[model samples]
Target: MLKFDHVSKVYKGGKKAVNDLNLEFNKGEFIVFIGPSGCGKTTTMKMINRLIEPSEGTIYINNEDIMKKDPVKLRREIGYVIQQIGLFPHMTIQENISLVLKLLKWPEEKRKARAKELLSLVDMTPDYLDRYPHELSGGQQQRIGVLRALAADQPLILMDEPFGALDPITRDSLQDEFKKLQKKLGKTIVFVTHDMDEALKLADKIVILRGGQLVQCGTPDEILREPANEFVEEFIGKERLVQAKPNITTVEQIMNPRPITIMSGQSLTEAITLMKQHRVDSLLVVDENHVLEGYIDVETIDQNRKKARLVGDVILPDTFAVEKNALVRDTIRQILKKGMKYVPVTDENNRLVGIVTRTSLVDIVYDSIWGDEAAAE
Candidate 1:
């Protein structure tokens, strides 16, 4: 429940970091600010907590102007997280997490309870309560930082790249955990990150900025499906644009559901016949359980037809395979690099699901970028 009216921030050197930004963050919605470096996304968020004052205009929280309120009192009502994971070295994990609660004059027992509760939310055991900041790993420390912000159950939270420092796997896991926590709590959150994928995944609404100016604001799907202009399109990047296209985000979305397959012990003649009937050059080879074993092409079959009677004798182990849930952009890159006509798609258990062909990818891209023009013609 925050609103910005004609907000602009100009520094001492007459440089504007934010230009006439007018926005409203709805209650219980996750809003993300995204753009390149020097785009003032951080500046925009900082202004909310009064860490950075705006040069002009007003910021309001629940119909009250923030500037008119005491900065310290205003900030106490809001939760804040930054990239640095700023935990005091001298404070124990429990103390650090309960810092905000303590400041609010919460009693010792309640603060301790809040600390334990927050730790459990992040999957940390209560034993961590006695540990210091240095005792935890980087990811653990960041988790504590997030917990600290939520320690007092503030109605609004501001996070500025809170997971940027962690490894990809850890960051991804935290993102999921944070999303769940946000939904469970229903707190209004303003998040700022340069990563488009993170914004697309997390934000209910995405606000794009460039050179300190509002470029576009909309839902992730809306922006992806229809960028405001060339700058907006380029900012979203080609890979994400592809992901935003209708029914083309993942390998499973484009994979041939019933790709021709032959059992391991099938005869070479049968493999050739299956290939001919399917009008394809290659056939996937599988075990009785339909688990992918390898593949055999017409050339391989022809070369070994005389000596190898069974398809298994000629099938070459599949070198390139992608999970069905993987991004289509990654599958496209592998296909292009390996000069493959199609790549095998497998389930999480490695059972063959289907195949993703180059043709499928090209068709999706074409329709996304130029399908409207072709339709007009």
Candidate 2:
């Protein structure tokens, strides 16, 4: 619900911070602006809330020019968050979150209810409402900063490197948490970051900038698969480039669709027969409807042949499975980390659809490493 039409920001001595940028953001989009330092990504975002006013062209939020609106009123309608997480140390968490509501003259009880509700959104308990900012950890305080922004239930939120100051682990956690929160709340977010991985993970659309101008703007997959030019290619890095090859991105593209399976009610003798017939050591167990139940292996069948009658009685129900649409890279990571031989692929309803084996990943890994050079030879 935001549009930048030929927008530019020129500072004193006529140095343009943002150069005639034109972009439109849809409702409920998670848009990230990213580039090298001093590339004007921050300035572009600040101009949205009038933190830094644009020098040329027009910025419209919901078709209304921001310049015509009162600055304070406009800011209250849009949420702003920063890396420092400016939660007032003197104010209690409840007071900090309810600041906007109080400024709007909301009733005391209504404000408290709003504060409590906002706290719950971030997984904070109501008891935290009475505590001061210093009592919480950095991550908690940052979460509070986000909650305060959401406190007013605004449709648009501007975030300027909100997770940059935290440690890598905490930063990664917050990125995932915020991405999920954005999807659940469906708030239009304009996030600014220097980290490409973070932008790729969190953004619905990425706006890349260079020398205060729009270089390229596209979804992560689009930019990764086909970079606009050498500059964009260098910015995305060679490792990411190889990993995001369009042909082998998703599990569905590489997984074997016809995995050998045995019915859960089938006898252990039949399970062995099926495994031998497929020339495989293990078989995925499924119900009559093709819904995945678990798995049975030659070893398990051999060990329990005399004791267990049906495959269901000896089946191992803790098999790991990935959804068909999961990224192959992600599935590979999980497979390696868990030391899995193969992973079952399932649809949303957990019906067995395909399987990804370690053997299947060897070619992908080789291709990612050698790239087109190997194919050309």
Candidate 3:
């Protein structure tokens, strides 16, 4: 939906912000521009909405040169989000969100409805509508900022480090939520961030830059498997390559299949017997269809052994079940951080498919850095 044809941006002092960039952003795709400080990620993004004008070359949206369009009219047709959120403190949440719609002369009822609909998309409710920016938390305020961008329903959206200011947990949560929202809405988004993990997690295509030049542009898997050069490899970090491998490695690739399990209806005695036979401290508890319910461990059994006759009575909620298609490195990092012994691997339907343990992670690391033969040895 957007194209950059030999685009270059040089400041008045002759510092190049972007150097002969040639790229295309497809419709309904989440494209991320990521790099270190002074890498021109923000510059390239700003040029999309004319916040920064290009020094040379043409930018096209659906084959029409953007230079031909008036800046105000062009901006109104495209959504722009920034790191600061830029919400008006005096305005209510509803008014903040509906500002763009109101500018476009949308009916009052329509604007109000859009605000409510957008809030609902982010799991916020009508109760938040009358509240001011200060009334909400940082994360909530950022959500409102995103809602404001989507309120006008523009086909093309440009986000410049939209989640950069939030804490790590909130940033990750927002990234996941925004990714889902993008897929559902099918809007073409050009997102900028310096964080490589964010790009790996959220981008359909990643464009890596350095020194105001394009370093590599490809799918996360493609870049992970084969970086364009030493600079690209270094930027991705050797540790990230070993641990998370981005889109290239998945839990399914290393997970142990046919993990020992106990049915929810199983007796505590049976659960104890199973654990002893398997020499495991815990056994995954599953329904008849093998859907993961939770788990029962020796500790839980010992605590409730006399009080609980059934395993279900002592079953502890499953806290960590890695998705089968999740990146092995990312999954391993989470598991190790939480000090978990193992994690169940579940399919899209939440059916238990396999398991991953520290031992399995060792095998994966060995196989990743070395060869299968070396791992076997």
Give me the candidate number with maximum lDDT.
2
Residue-by-residue lDDT tens digits, candidate 2, 1-377: 89999999999998999999999989999999999999999999999999999999999999999999999999999998999999999999999999989888999999999999988888889999999999999999999999889988999999999999998768867876888999999999999999888888888999999989999999998899889999989988886677687888889998999999888888888877777777999999999889999998888888887889998899899988899999876677567756889999999999999999998888777877786787889
| Number of the predicted model whose TM-score against the real structure is largest | 3
Q: Lowest-lDDT window of 10 residues in candidate 1?
A: 329-338
lDDT of 2 at 108: 94
Cand. 2 TM to true fold: 0.78
- TM-score order of candidates, best first? 3, 2, 1
Error of 3 at 315 (Å): 2.2
The CA lDDT at 205 in model 2 is 98
What lDDT would candidate 2 get against the real structure? 0.90
Give per-model TM-scores.
0.73, 0.78, 0.92
Ranking by lDDT: 2, 1, 3
Candidate 3: segments with Cα more than 4 A from true spot: 243-248, 336-339, 372-377
Please report, in order, the local distance difference test score of every candidate based on alpha carbons: 0.89, 0.90, 0.89
RMSD of each: 6.8, 4.8, 2.5
Give the alpha carbon lDDT tens digit for every residue of 1-377 in model 3. 89999999999999999999999888999999999899999999999889899999999998989989999999998988899989999999999999999999999999998899899999998999999999898899999988888888899999999998999879878987999999999999999998887888889999999988999999987887788999888988887777655434788988899799998788999988898898999999999999999998899899987799998898888557989988876787677756899999999999999999888978766766786457499
Clashes of 2: 0
The clash count of every prediction, one per candidate, is: 0, 0, 1
